[model samples]
Target: MTYAITQTCCADATCVAVCPVNCIHPTPEERDFGSTEMLHIDPKTCIDCGACADACPVDAIFPVESLSAAQREYGPLNAAYYEGREAGSVTSGPNFHAWGEPVFERVLPSGFAPVRVAVVGTGPAGMYAVEDLLLHTGAEVTLIDRLPVAGGLIRYGVAPDHPSTKKVQDVFARFHAHPRVRMHLGLDVGKDVTHRELAAHHDAVVYAVGAGADRRLSVPGEDLPGSLSARTF
Candidate 1:
């Protein structure tokens, strides 16, 4: 029997990055990914290689035979998710090969008034949002960050020895200079600017604030005075 993804799934799609076969449905490329309740494995296409299970961070996958009685219904549920849907193109993994040329088209309306958008963090997500919006629309993006520097983890969290990793932030440099993008640093949103004030000043506000917390350690003496989180250390 094939493996099935059960109810505890977080749907981060890291599993898709490792699967050799393109057997998953509503992949990250799909427009409905953010809205979909969960990702499903196609019973007909799954090779049973178990790579998706290995990549899953939450350990949500299980072999159909190994499923608990309560999860037995998931086998049919997974299959039902693929009903009437065709298999997707294999865009990832070592087996991936060249595909046909992609078509370019203009999706947004032409000559629309510039949209003033306040993006509430300057990490990779906020930078990507600014890049995508500026590429597609005449949006004037304002990046806001509480740190004096613009980049979130790229500027502070990443280890300094990993210069190559930090160098990738160079790609974001051009965005800082983009006429459409405005950078505001060392500004706490709730303290200096209220949500109401931001709403009144811009059409939309995007929060890319990185993870709010860290995993707590369970070891003895973990609470020692010198202890520091990776973000702080």
Candidate 2:
């Protein structure tokens, strides 16, 4: 059976890097990659190797046969992405994501002091920024979150039924204990620590705090009791 990419995709492109046959479409280098909500797998070219499923950071990929009733539509959705496009079309030169030359030069100048950075959130975005800083730069990171626990959206946003989706939290937890990282939880930015205070201590303060607004259905009784938004429930 072929694998399918579902809506939980973060568009991180980790899956694309591992697919041996290159069945996943719209590699990060492609012009359309940014516009597409999620990447799709070409069923015709998929060899059922499951490499993409293993590499997916958000657990968005799965076998077509295992899709639940709500997710069954994704199987067709993945196939629909390549309706008119020819097989092996993504492997062509223009769409191929080729590796670039690596530069070993230091980003910081000689005698430059290491900077302190503060990332405000513990979700995927915040953790990614933390990972990039620790791996690519010499910045010391201070991680902050209003909740007592970490894993902002991954902990609260995802449904409990989908345990696999929540597994990504383990990946983010690694950076929490990094030597260069200092974590503060249950600390409100404005009440506990003001923006001016953070700016004073850090070279840069990144606000990865996710959106708080809910979508409007514009229908009667949408706001009535027993009605719950995705985050509210």
The candidate maximizing TM-score is 2
Per-residue lDDT of model 1, residues 1-233, tens digit only: 68888876657676776766667667787787868667788887777889988777657788888999998998999899888776655555565533448766646566667889999988878888887788877889988998888888777877888664565467677889898888889999999999899989999999898964677888888789998888778
Model 2 weakest 10-residue run by lDDT:
89-98
lDDT of 1: 0.79
Residue 123 Cα positional deviation in candidate 2, in Å, after optimal superposition: 2.0
Off by over 4 Å in 2: 34-37, 63-73, 86-106, 212-230
- Model 2, span 94-117: residue lDDT tens: 334344588776588877888899
Evaluate all candidate structures by whole-model CA lDDT and list the values in order.
0.79, 0.89
Deviating ranges (above 4 Å) for candidate 1 = 1-106, 212-220
Record all residue pairs in model 2 with backbone atoms less than 3 Å apart, i.e. clashing.
none
Task: Give the winner by lDDT.
Answer: 2
Per-prediction TM-score: 0.55, 0.76
